[model samples]
Target: MACLGFNPAKIRNQNLHYSKPSSKIVPSSKPIKIKPSPSQFSFKLHCLKSNSVSEAPLSPTEPQISEQEEEVDDPASELSFLDPEIDPESITEWELDFCSRPILDIRGKKVWELVVCDSTLSLQYTKFFPNNVINSITLNNAIASISDDLGVPLPEKIRYFRSQMQTIITKASKELGIKPIPSKRERYETVYQRHPGFQKGAKPFLTLDNPFPMDLPDNLFGEKWAFVQLPFSAVQEEVATLKRTFTFGASFDVELLGIEIDDKTLIPGLAVATSRAKPLAAWMNGLEVCSIEADTARGCLYLSVGISTRYIYATYKKTPTTTGEAEAWEAAKKACGGLHFLAIQEDLDSDDCVGFWLLLDLPPPPV
Candidate 1:
């Protein structure tokens, strides 16, 4: 299989509307906008009947510190007051961001900072730096100091989403024997709220705008596809009891979204049947799929993935029937808090799926 480069010009259709985050259930007449930022690149392979999905809370001995640990003017001073005995469930993986904040320092320049936290956010460490000194070596030293001061073991992996900072982050992680993964699934840091610059409410310093949709490799295209839907209860039950060898992509408890998912509510989705099922599924597995969008006017379906990458996953000739299906998909997705799915199979008759991705257009974090 050949690795294809992302070419934005290939599918830059101006007719497509990029959605902004919204909470209202979009009517069929409105263009639904479900804007969620980057997602984690996590592909799982386990039997549906054999494996159970869940999130485990941090261990009991670990203190549940404030979501964002206290921040100070000086990075070095952080080590002085931090409880050396602070433990957070033996966290082995961390989310990292060494970026400028929405605030500025007394020097009339934006403050740069290195922020680190585990997935559950039970452990958080932050340090502010002057712009000139932001480098891999500085990052490496800060991480080392945090490890020594907290008596916590160094993480095995550090995940960061800012692609521009990949080189520096990778260099720092490699020097410390940690694997670095670029993923969009990092949570926004709330520590900035305490800063004076944000007291009046300011936009994030760094945000990935939605890029133009690109084309999938021609060879991996599916033969047949359709807009589909199923009751939420059926989908949830199948996920729990279905007999399957493997599945991958995003999965989370509906309760975590803060939106109630009524059992009988209909959930919209896309289903593809093709001889290239395995390969198509394989390619998608590598991506952090965000959500699927339908353009009723153009009669096309777009796949939103990674931090802000979009793809022309499929297109249909403009017809009333096709346009109606697209509208229904958009309307249903909006009704369900931007929840949707993608399923790949050899053909409609096949009892098993090559892949299934539970995609969501996540709402923006609270202010």
Candidate 2:
């Protein structure tokens, strides 16, 4: 008996031949036909369906978007956005002069303009006291006339004319003697009756024996004593200086006129009726005649040269009497000099009354 040896190469060749021949062989009989169920077909279709819907056609949506866009682009809508930027409060008082002045329309545009000889004068003071501030008024009448031609308002135009007239009068008053007068009123009867040796009929009631002084709490009284008197030639210079400082030449054309000077004898010991009485008397004796009647008529001058006569008098504490008040009225008359004295009345029944008096400068004669 003999053992058989395995042939590895022969076995490998046989396995290769079997694998190759089976892969190449074709089936002899026809394949059986099969059909899928409807459920299975539906499931396959669902899996293949698109995730997102297709957009609608352009015609329907485009017109709506365009109409909405046009509304937002309207001109009126644009104007509404700009309204808040132009607020009136942003304008200042000085700028109001442009509004008050005559408006000029050229090339369909509006503007306010002025011309002045002395620009400095134009820079100060408004047509009204505090409110209507002008940048600078023109001194030249021609320029002002030009402004008028441009349809500027009358009030604004006249302010310049009046200011110039005032300057001239103020200058003339300096050449002549004139002054501002104190305007305080007080009563004399009670004060005089209280005094010793006060006679009902005596000459010069405003003499040293009787004096009207300020009657106010010391704290409220101003340090400068206010006196009532006729202004001297030098007074105009002082007024000009004052105009430069306080009012800025606003009321320069004002004057005092219609002055009537008189001297009367009264009870010598009677207390001076008004705080202004003594100073008024002094002013009457010192008045200078106005050189130019035209200038004098402007009412540019104050009724009296009101100065601080005495600090002590300004701070006096005694209550005023009726006679004392009458005396004060007389003093105002004297201070007014050329101007007639109107009746004096207490403004209020308080210490403040002693400090306030309304002395009107003579009005301009009817034109």
Candidate 3:
């Protein structure tokens, strides 16, 4: 654009050293692409209505505003105020900062949504509800109230449900005694002690082997396979990477190993939990549900370690202990205080693998 009140030829000649300004009008044979530099050009835009021109690169003597103009303030610079009604289920500032999950009453032939949100199971229900209140008692009542609706025992799962919801029948609403499911810390200690390989570490400072597993007296070729729990922080990345590594057709990965195994027969296998921040549901008899906070609970938490070739579910906490489970569970409950981190050793241990069998009975989800 030509600068107003200035000669176009003189300005073009001054700015473009390559182009010569001619008295005669001429068209170029080739298409010309010219991009003007900002600093080299100065222009004024005049408003036809106001008869005012805004000048670029104004001089010190130039006035910023005219006598006719009024100063205006930016509307965005001011803060906006709102008086929205607070949500009833929303957690107040005084309330504890905790997550909650929706109570899904699955006991009926058709699933029902409960009004109350169980904070313990809530973090898992974020996918379903935008906001929820955290109250376990309401959830407990919801499950207990549904017993009349339950006709036949549920397929494989509903029959196994017990912990907080275990009554001969669920119909009795009044004085519904909701038993406390074991806290995360207690469950881990109980499971760890009941595990034969981990029994040595139950009362520490004992002569537990370097691998820490105690082979059974009758069993030959004691299962060397074990597990080591990493801090819960790495659970997401490790689980994601594990899924990729264990994808079908993927080969043996030495990167996943806890220790180097020299023997060709001793190969390693691993299973990582996917929920890093997610609350895992600890199903009690398929009725009462307790929320197991990630990394805090021992529900299905297992990651394989050690020099074993065959994969076995023996080390898995889901299995009933070979011995003394009831006693360990009782003692662990007394010790729990809502916080725990397991003893760390470079070499973790696992049970000795025994001869296998085909699957018939599907294991129930632990509390």
Candidate 4:
């Protein structure tokens, strides 16, 4: 690490600071402690569901309740049956995006819009408001309008990605009795083209030009690191192996992203071994890790996380050997549709991995 030739002080100063709401703050000055789980972190894909098996069949000696009788026995069931509005089962969660768009109204002022879509991407509700009227009261009204529509149900949870809009969005969601989650998923783009700005063939207004990669905190750096990979056939087996032992880090179903990999496909990865595995893994658990990219020109590795934030993971002296690996890693990542992994361990020989993240380089959201 000493010979990596990177200065933490310079990296920190070079970082691009993003603004968040002042009313609420997430304390990131110290490592976040997360309760360890057996499998791993997940993006909570909707395509997967857990099946619960009945523990035991009903005994013949026990009283049998007829389906009709059971409905009559429960008073709450009567009220639910009587009401035809708001089928909660229709939508479990909604992805929301509230931001300024490139389009301007007739008055020539910036237009602000609220977009809401269900997890299945089948239903959407969009409402536009002038800049002056953007607030929790207005947002709450817009959501209520959607819920009041015939057969449209209010979602149990609402997820929004932009941290800058957290305060107002959280307020609106709470007022509507929906749990608000800050997530980094880009599912909101499904309805982007429907926006009026893009309807007339307007050019895309935004592109992700991430800033220079900044070095991670000195203490968090691993003692040693290496580029590694596993055949697609062995990934599930490896995950099952890690589950029986100690493990931490993020993971998601590749099928959730609509990606299909052949058994022979190689999944590129980075493995880091360090004595500070506990804190390093804990810190990574707090991030919405997107992907890792190799910069062979500068002989650096960059990690993209939490919206548009970028960090310098490692740096090495440029050479034919290192350059070849870097290019190969890049090619493999592209072949896998940006699917990759990061593993942290106590040491190279240790059987237990402290951290492992299944990262995806999702395409940028629609401008």
The prediction achieving the highest TM-score against the true structure is 1
Global lDDT scores for all candidate models: 0.59, 0.22, 0.20, 0.59
Across 260-353, the per-residue lDDT of candidate 3 in tens digits comes to 2222111112211212101111111121211111112322221112211111212322223311222232222222211111111111221211
lDDT of 2 by residue, 18-60 (tens): 1111111111122222222111011111111111111122365
**TM-score-best of 1 and 3:** 1
Q: Report the C-alpha lDDT of model 4 over 1-367, residue by residue, as the tens digit.
A: 1011011111222232222212211111222222232111121212111111111234789677665543333111101111234354677788787876655554656566666765444455445566788889988887787777525667788877676777898999999899887766532223233322323444433344556677687655776666666666656556665566646676655554566676655677777777788898888877767688889898778987765568888776656655666787777677677777877777655655678777876565554
How high is the lDDT of residue 180 in model 1? 88
Cα lDDT for residue 237, candidate 3:
32
TM-score of 3: 0.18
Error of 3 at 69 (Å): 52
Ranked by TM-score, the better of candidates 1 and 4 is 1
lDDT of 2: 0.22
Report the candidate with higher lDDT, 1 versus 3. 1
- lDDT, residue 38, model 2: 11
lDDT of 4 at 120: 44
